[model samples]
Target: MVKESKLLPRPEFQRRLVWSRDDKNHFLDSVLRGYPFPEIYFADGDVNLETGEGTQLLVDGLQRVSTLIQYFDGDDNLKLTSAPTYRALNEDEKKAFLQYDVAVRDLGGISKEEIIEVFKRLNATKYSLLDIEINNAVYAGALKTFCEQIAEKDFFRAHNIFNASDYKRMGDLRYVLSLVGTMVQGYFNRDDAFENLLDRYNDEFPMHAEISGRLQNIFDFIEECGFDPKTRAWKKADLFTLLIELDQVLHIRNERLQPSKVLEELTSFYDGVDSSGVNQGSVSSIYYKAALQASNDKINRVRRGAIIGGILLELSESEIREKLRVEGLA
Candidate 1:
């Protein structure tokens, strides 16, 4: 009922909701069975300088709280052991559920730093969250939302990048953010591009929208090209480079290219990468020799981008050459 005091993750500190369906089912079932649960921790954030009010900021239980809210609000249909849904419960069952006492440990009069420390300690358990999830938790804005939108698109599915589970835990979003980040920086390994860009989303709202639009355009073109999703051409490194190289291809005012021809060139480029290069440890292997390790290594990124960029320029026809040259991708 306290909308103003809704459980808030420290701005830019928490991660996305990661509980799976089974996790939620088990949790609701446990609650229905009167099983004891962990204590929810909250910090009393000092008086609001602007609103002149104290607030209970949640330090933990983000996913747990979200699960219950979705279930009760009919936003999610959670199947339980004894009941198909919460609405199906008998009068006594509903009463019991309503009366269940959730334990909340209040860490009032604590500094914000102390609450964050407690959060870090609590989440450092066997069920630790992924770094991307923690990163996603920290910031929410046009950039984060835009990345999420692209992650769920059919482009990722057709390209075999990730599936529902990845989206559920925000892996796909993180992946897209990485790609966009790498593109924005034009160089990898210097910094966490996603983190830096996300922090700038609020101030760079228009720029965020511009970048998001470019991403959407890029993905749309990818669908048009229709490359084999299974090809090494679709690897994160390969795709990232190709995308940056063709950055001008999606411009509304730019000249267009032969989509099928582009796909053919992309396939050919990866084939060469698969066959080229010497034994260079992680980048070694006969089957995928030129392929960089699926990591953000600096040299790997530069080499991968250069190789793909070379092919992209070679494949571009006269129609889009003027634009590509202007963008310096030529």
Candidate 2:
């Protein structure tokens, strides 16, 4: 109830709601089963010494409290393991639920930075969201907004470039940002390259919008070229490489691109790779893993971009050829 009060504002710093339905259901199940929850931390505020009224800001556990309030109010359609909803509970169930004690540690007059630190320390999990989601929360400016536009586009849905969870977790948005970031910076580093670009999004907010526009144009070109859906070109490293290279050179091309031809060339390139000493069975996974790893390396990024450029050059695509020459690339 205090959460709804404007006197205590906790929305100043909070993680994105990336919890899955299953995760919420599991938590709700545990609550209904009388299991104890972890201590939720709060920042203490000033109080009226006489009336004993004061405001407290939540430092952590927003999701948990949100889920509880949502379930009790029968607002969200959460699948319950034990009962329908808090409102559906019997008198005894209601009494037990109300009587259930939740642990809380309130720090008086905590600084905002200290509260954010506490919040981060508490949510250290595989779903800890130290990447795009967290960054989006802190920098809820143009970058986050542009990412939303890209993720919500019909092109991504129709092409299956990214899914619902990818959107929720900001994976798809990060992928596009990574490609654009790599191309714009003229290099790809195995470490910190992506991180540095994301941090710059706060200041380079307008650039993200321009990049989004170019990206949409590139996707349109890919579809116009007739890329085969069976090639799964819409996913992973191949798509990343293709998009980066196309954005660099295709804008100035006088002729249209042939997606089927590009797919065929790419497929042939993969099929003809030599794995002389690689073991059979699951060992092929090593090569697959290596290809993915190369997707981030400086040398490999240049190589992959050059491969696409070479193909276009062969077809008298002078724009790609000129780009390679000017960039001092093969």
RMSD of each: 6.3, 5.8
Q: What TM-score does each of the candidates earn? A: 0.73, 0.74
Give the Cα lDDT of each candidate: 0.65, 0.65
For 119-145, candidate 2 gives per-residue lDDT tens digits of: 776778766755654555456555556
Q: Where's the lowest-lDDT run of ten residues in candidate 1?
A: 281-290
**Model 1 C-alpha lDDT per residue in residues 230-310, reported as the tens digit of each score:** 777577656766676667444532656678878987786566556666563221232243244544655556555554554
Candidate 1, 184: how far from true, in Å?
Answer: 2.3
